[model samples]
Target: MDSFSGSSRGGFAPRGGRGARGRGGRAPFLTKTRETNPDLEKHPLGCLIKEFGSPDLGLNPVDLAKISDCQYVASYNWLNDEVPTIVIPGKPPQWTPLQEPQRLKEDSGQYFRDPNAAMYPDYPMAPVVNAVLETDSEFDAARTDVFACGSTLGNLLRFARGIDKAFRFNVVVIGDTVFFMRKDNDPREVIKDVRGFGHTFPEAYTTWEHSVKGSETHQRIIRYKFGGFSCLVRFESDGYIPDSSAVTNTTPANTAVGQGDLFQAFQGATISQQPTINKLGSLKIKQGGSPVPQKSIFDLKTRSGKYKKDIDMSDILPQLWINQIPNFIVAYHDGRGLFEDIRVRDVSDDVQAWVTDNSDGIRRFATLLDKIVDIARSNSDKLLEVYCPGKEHLEVREQYGDGAHALPADLRDGLDGSKDGDGGDISDGDEYYDSDEYGFDNRSDDSSEELDYTACSAHDCGYCGKCTY
Candidate 1:
C-alpha cells in the first residue's frame, strides 16, 4: 500500500481531481439516516473482553503452498423488488467491452446498500450458507474454520497490520465455522451519496446478459485454504467476461430455465428439487446462466485522467488477493465524464507478487484470525463482537443483548445439530457488563467533528468517518 502523506491527524493528501474539495468545500458524501432496529444500539457491551495483541511478525512465515486454489462454490443475485429476490447461481454482469468514448452520467442516488441484508432481511449470511449447501449437500461444515465476507476479512487484515480505521463486526460460531458478520446500523442504510462515475461507468459498461435482468447486484461465494484454515469467503463481483469456448458451445436450450419449474426452493432442497415451490421468506430462487470460471471475473474502478493519474494497483491488490479475482479494469475519464482510456489487465502476477512481498503482514493476519477464532470458541455464549476504535486495539467482547444468530433457527439447527430452536429470534443472554468496566468510551459522535473534508475522497479513503472530507 502507498504511504499516506499529509496532516499529523493521519489524513492523506488529496489525490488531484475535479472532485477534490478542501476542508471548507461541499461535503463529499454522508451515510443516510434510516430507522433501524432499535435493538441494534441496545446490544450492550460484555464483561468478557479480549484485547488485540501484536503477533510476532518475524516468526513462522505463512506457507504460501497452503493457500489452496479458490473454488467457485455458489452465487446469487439481488433482484430489484419491494421484497428481496435471490436467484441461485445467478448471472453476473457480462463484461462487454466498450467500443467508443461516451459521456457517462454522474452517479446519483443511494450508493452503498448492504445487499446481504436487503436480499435476506431475516439473516444476511443465510443466503451464502443456503447457496453453499444447495450447491454441495455433502459439504463438511465441521472442517470449515472461517466463514466471512471480503469486507470483514479485509478489515481484519488491515487491523492486523495496523493500517485500517476503526470498524466493528459480529462473530458467531455455527458448528466449527466462525462467521464474521458485517454489522451496520441498517441493512438498507445509504452508505454514501453518488458523486462520480464509479457507479455510472459500470452501468454503461456491463450487460446483464441473462433472463435475470434488473438485478441490483451479484454476489459470489468461494472456498479456499489459507494458513492451514479452510475459509469460505463471500464477495460481490463487479462483473464477468464470457468464456469464448462456453459462448460458442452454449445453446438456448442449455441456458433456459423450464417455464413450469423456474422458481425453486432454496432451503433444504436437493438438485432434484431444481423446480420446487418451497419459498424461504420473500426470497425467490431461480436457476439460470452458465457458470463462468473465476479467471473471467474482474474488479473495476473509475479514476480521473485530468492529471494523468494512474490507478494505483497497490491500493486494490489486497482486495483482489482476498477474493482471488484475476482480472482488473480501470477506466480513466477526462474529468468531464468522457472516458477514452480504458484498460483491462490480467493482474494475477501482480497479485501473487504482492502476496510474496507482504508475507510478514499476511502471517500476522493469519495469526489474528486464529486468535479471534480461539477467543470466540472459548466464550461460553459462542457469540462475540469484534470492535476497534480508530487506530486502536481490537476488543472481543460478549455479544450485546440477547445475541443475534447468523442464521435462522432451522438453518442453525441444520448446520450444527443444535436444537435451541427459537426461529431466529433475538434472545437475551445472561452476560452483560458496564461499559466503564472495560474503559469503553463512546466515540461514535467524534468522527464527524474530526473529519478533514479537504483530505477525503471516495477514491482515496472511502469517507471512513475518521477524516472529514
Candidate 2:
C-alpha cells in the first residue's frame, strides 16, 4: 500500500475513468467553480456558462415538468457570479424574511430540495423547508397526492399548455438546482442561500409585497426588492455548492387549505391575459416529518366499481380559470413591459415540430383537469363538495353529484322542469300534474299528497295540457 500527498506521494489507485490515471486527475466534484465546473460557452460571447452539464434526463410524461424548473434555476444563478470569495473571522448576514409564515411559505411556490448537503444557516441556498413529500411512483396516486411530482405536473403542464398564450410561461424547466453562496461555514454569519436549478434566472428578481401607501388604492408597488426573487423556480439536478440538508415539507396545514393559491394563480393569469407563475417551493424532510397519511386507492377503486377508470369527463369544470402570477407577468411583459421577457431559444426542428403538431391549450387543459378532478375526488368522504362558477362566471353553484363524476356530463345538457314546460322542453313535474289537472297550475289542493308517476313520459295523451312540451 502506498500513500501519496499532492506533489510526490501517490497510492490508493486513484479510481476513475481512463482520464483519471493521466498526469492531471479530475476532481470528483468541484468545491470552487474552476475546480470542476468547466466553462462551457453555451451563450454568445461567453455571456452564459453551462452551470449544469449533466446528461439530459428523460422528460417522460411523469418528469416533463422539472425540465423547465431546472433550466430556469441554472440560468438564474449564472449572472454576476464572479469567483466566490471565502470569508474568515465572521460578520452577521442579513435577510428579509416575511412577518407572516403563511406569506413566507407561499413565496416559493415550486422548488427543489437537496438532502445530502451540509446543514447550516450559512449555507448559500434557500434552506429546504422540511414539510413536503417527495415523489415515489407513477403507478400510484399517493405517490403524487399533492406531492407535486409527475402526475401533478403531467396534469398541470398538459393543462397549462391549453391555457391561452397570454398565460403560457416562457417557462424553461432545466434539470438541476443551485444556491447563491459565499465561501464561509459559520452559523453566526448571514445566509443568502437562494437555492434552485438551471440557468435562466437572473442573479435577482422583483417580488411583490402588499402595500397601501397611495390613496384608496391597492396598486402594485414595485421596486427591485432583490434581483433574485424575480427568477424562476430553482431546481437541484444541477450541481449545488456543498449540498444543503434535506428540507422538512408539510401538506396543507389543513385540507380546507384548498388549492385556492394554485387555482387563483391560474385563473387570474388567464383573466388578466398573462402568464401565471405560482412558484411553489416544497421540500420534504427525509428523516423527520409527521407520517404522511394516504387514502387507500384500493377502497376508492372498489367504490368506483367497474367505473374505476371510467372517467366522468364532465366532472372537469369547463374552464378552471388558472390565474397565476407568472401568467400575468408574461402577459404584462408582452403588452406593457412590466416583467422581463425571456428570449425564445431555437429548439431542434423535431422538438419544434412536436410542439407545433401536438400543441393545444383547450384540449390539454380540459383533459388534465378531468384527471385532477378524478384523482382529487377519490377522497373517502364520498360526500365531498366540489364547485365552480356557473353560467355567468359570477355565481358559484353547488351540486349533489359524484365527486369522481364532477364533470361526467355537461350541466347545461339537461333542462330543469321550470324552463321546459313554458313552451320549451317537456317537464317531469308538469306531466305528473297534467293527468287530471292543468299541469303546473293546479295550485295547492292536498299539499301532503305524493305526486303520482302514472302520467309519466309514456302515459301522455292528446290532451296536450297533461302532455309535456
Per-residue lDDT of 464 in model 2: 9
Candidate 2 vs. true structure, TM-score: 0.17
True lDDT of residue 293, candidate 1: 73
C-alpha lDDT of residue 295 in model 1 = 81
TM-score to true structure, per model: 0.73, 0.17
lDDT of 1 by residue, 107-183 (tens): 44332335566445568887787666656655668878899987688777777666746667789987677899877
- Could you tell me the lDDT of residue 292 within candidate 2? 9
**Candidate 2 C-alpha lDDT tens digits along 127-147:** 211111011111121211121
Q: Over 4 Å off in model 1, which ranges? A: 1-44, 55-60, 64-66, 243-281, 417-469
Looking at model 1, residue 425 earns an lDDT score of: 23
Give the best candidate by TM-score: 1
